[model samples]
Target: MYRPKTTLEQWRILQAVVDHGGYAHAAEKLNKSQSSLNHAVAKLQSQLGVQLLEVRGRKAYLTEAGEVMLRRSRHLTQNVQDLESLAANIQQHWEPEITLAVDLAFPRSLLYPSLQQFLPECRGSRLKIIDTVITGTEEAITQGWADLVISHHVPKGHLGEVIAQVNFLLVCHPEHPLSQTSGPIDPNELSQHLQLVIADTSQSPDEKQGWLKSEARWTVSQFHTAVDLLLQGIGFCWLPEHVVQPHLADGLLKQLDLDGSSFRRLVSYLVKPRPDNIGPGSQLLYDLILSNRQVIRQDDNTATTGNNP
Candidate 1:
């Protein structure tokens, strides 16, 4: 067994020599004397009982054994750097990790922008983003699984700040039977056709919600699935305008002229009630959401008139 008493400084000097092409350049980069850099590498080679470097022309090249040691040294150095970063983050009172439960109804355009804004400030922190349906966000918070939640429903007695509003449009493929109707289609008329519905992703999966009067209904777990099915001319369903905007513009889907104005749902961002439970990372995220609330609430052009709430 080749037991070497090589310090990290010796390995660092060895790597620097290979990286910078020569001991002279490595000494310049590390702000050390060329003799010191040379001595460190020489000591490492002697301790390891191996010839680690061979100078060809002006530069030094690592021998095969030296290459193996260099690779392992990289992992060790990276782990040390990570530990330093974690220590610094802890000193700043930032959470090591934060969990955010967001509603599926929340548009990606809005969600991504918020995350982009949060990334720079919380570089050392980790984030877990959960996409949920109506009650999924609620369940995550109640179960202590989420530190922050962006949801349409606020649990009773918990104060929620309205962050944005998502407008829902009843849309279907152009060739569907509903598109052939002469005027505003009645709710009774809608009950006859197949309705595509996104299944609630909560523990209580049977809790029927939304305008689902249609006896013939197909259920799915994601809005993307429902959108895909709509594009395939499989069924008609009420979907978020933001998710379906490009399709509407491409003429793949058309809004049904319903009896009333468009249906709009207001969404809110809620921090877990106990202030002590939130850390610096979660607090920064919550502040960003509050600041960008109005920007996310703006209406999109895809909305048409509807009568139902």
Candidate 2:
């Protein structure tokens, strides 16, 4: 294996000398002798066969080569610092990465804000968000694929906290046959038309959710696809109010006037797949979701009522 001639310490010393303006100031800041700082930088330049710094008057400045190398070296030093921080975090029981499985029905309004809050406080930890539908969320929990899960269903053996309730509204394109129907739409009428459904993203897909009373159904893997199909006036399906809010507001989509309830409220839970071994990062995210649960509920109510609360 080929070895590097210079060390990270040497590069760091060079950066300090340039950042602090000269050897004397850098030594004072780093609590090292000026001669030692000069020696380290000199040794680095000698090993690389490059004159990295030019001394004039009482200050040191970078040469053309030194300017390019210093820019690259700053990145290298920052990476090393991050690596050390990651190692320290690992030692303190902070997870290096956390996998979060969220149900398709969950509100993006709530999920995104929680993630935004968690980003800065994660302490170098990485987040993996898995967008799951129906049985897919349950699979993520039971199969040990996720550290945190937000789903409509909490599997048999695991415990979950009710985090948010999403309103799934039955909707169709404004120009569709359903939109022209007068008064309360009959269930029999719904079964005659095609329904666009989101397919279960699991190994073993389960029965489709909502008014599957229709014999003619089109299934897709994602909500966006379903929304696209709905926009074409092709079919009708129950979609989360948040996902369809903009379309509804724009008159691109309209909620169907069903005889009974026009919307279904799905209560999503925050579950820990490995509760006993929950890391600080996962727990922090969990707490954030819980703290923001009320805000999610308020948003849901606002969406349903068409008035700000």
TM-score of each: 0.80, 0.91
Candidate 1 structure lDDT? 0.79
**Structure candidate 1, residue pairs in collision:** 260-306, 260-307, 261-306, 261-307, 262-306
Per residue, candidate 1 scores C-alpha lDDT tens digits across 1-309 of 966487878988888998898999999999999999888988888988999898899789988988898899989877878788888888877778888888888876666666789998885788988888877667876676888888877777566776666779999999999989988988888889999988777887545457878999998988889989988888889899888889999999998987764465555555564466778789888887766564341355333222211
| Residue pairs that clash (backbone atoms under 3 angstroms), model 2 | none
lDDT of 2 by residue, 93-151 (tens): 99999999889888777777778899899998988888999988889999878999998
Worst 10 residues of 2 by lDDT: 300-309
Off by over 4 Å in 1: 1-6, 16-37, 47-50, 55-72, 87-93, 206-208, 268-273, 296-309
Best by TM-score: 2
